[model samples]
Target: MTGHVVWHGRRVAFRRGESLASALMAAGVHNLGQAATGQARGVFCGIGQCQNCLVRVGDRLTEACLLICEDGLIADPDAGGRDG
Candidate 1:
């Protein structure tokens, strides 16, 4: 099954049970965060152990790889003006 999700104010398509990070990457969104040295970051570890693939879901910080893609799921890649 598939669902509609929004990322960075843009609509994206995702399949059920899929991670938001995968959906974002499939949509050509690899730059999920910026490093202090101005480096782009995405998924380093597919599991939730790593905090590299962090994104904002509402007001909470969550790991994109651990978050299941769902309909109407809203996420901000650069939330809190981090890495931007």
Candidate 2:
């Protein structure tokens, strides 16, 4: 079995070792993270290049495009939360 992601308290399907961005997309989440524009903002530059797809992994923040998904992970959006 892959894994599951908690989006806004909603349990979503995900695969282990897969990037958060891909998982979000599989879950039909376009707005990976909120941007200066609004909640409908998303970006490219996958991997560890850009910090566009930022999300909260547990108590820490991480790039959704790069960080690999794990089983039972609580992920949340955080575009306005951190600038890193």
Candidate 3:
């Protein structure tokens, strides 16, 4: 099944088994957020190892590559900020 998630307040569609990173990338959202040094961040390793695809899901930080896309899910790309 396919559905949409709230990505940075924008709706991004995804398949049921798709990861958050994959969904965001398909929507042309490459720049997930800025690092502490103001460098742009995105999915690097494509796995949960690099910590580059960090996104705020609810009140916790999680790897976008590891998070399965869910309908109506709210993901804050910029929520990582300096602490990411």
Candidate 4:
């Protein structure tokens, strides 16, 4: 099944079983957030090993590469407090 998730307040479509990182990247959202040194961060390991893809899902910080895309899922890049 296909559905949409809220990314930075915008709706991004994704298929069931797809990771949040994959879906966001497919939707042209490459820059997930900023690093502590003001460098842009994105998917690196694609297996949740790297902390580059961290984003705030609701109130908790998680790796987007490991997070499955679900309907109505909300991801806020700025909420992770990594925006430098």
Q: For model 3, how does the per-residue alpha-carbon lDDT over 1-84 read when each residue is reduced to its tens digit? A: 489999878999999899999999998999887777778889999979999988888877899999998899998865346543
TM-score for every candidate vs. truth?
0.85, 0.78, 0.90, 0.90
Q: On a 0 to 100 scale, what is the lDDT of residue 15 in model 2?
A: 67
Worst 10 residues of 1 by lDDT: 75-84
Task: State the displacement of the C-alpha of residue 51, model 1, in Å, after optimal TM-score superposition.
Answer: 0.7
RMSD of each: 2.1, 3.0, 2.1, 2.0
Q: Considering lDDT, which of the candidate structures 1 and 3 is the better prediction for this target?
A: 3
Model 1: runs farther than 4 Å from truth? Answer: 79-84
- Cα lDDT tens digits, model 1, 1-84, are 498799988999998888999998899889887655666778998898878888888877888999999899999875335543
lDDT of 2 by residue, 22-51 (tens): 888887887866776665444478766777
Please report the TM-score between candidate 1 and the true structure. 0.85
lDDT scores in order: 0.83, 0.74, 0.86, 0.88
lDDT by residue for model 4 (1-84), tens: 499999999999999899999999999999998877777889999998988999888668899999999899999784237442
Candidate 2 lands at a TM-score of 0.78
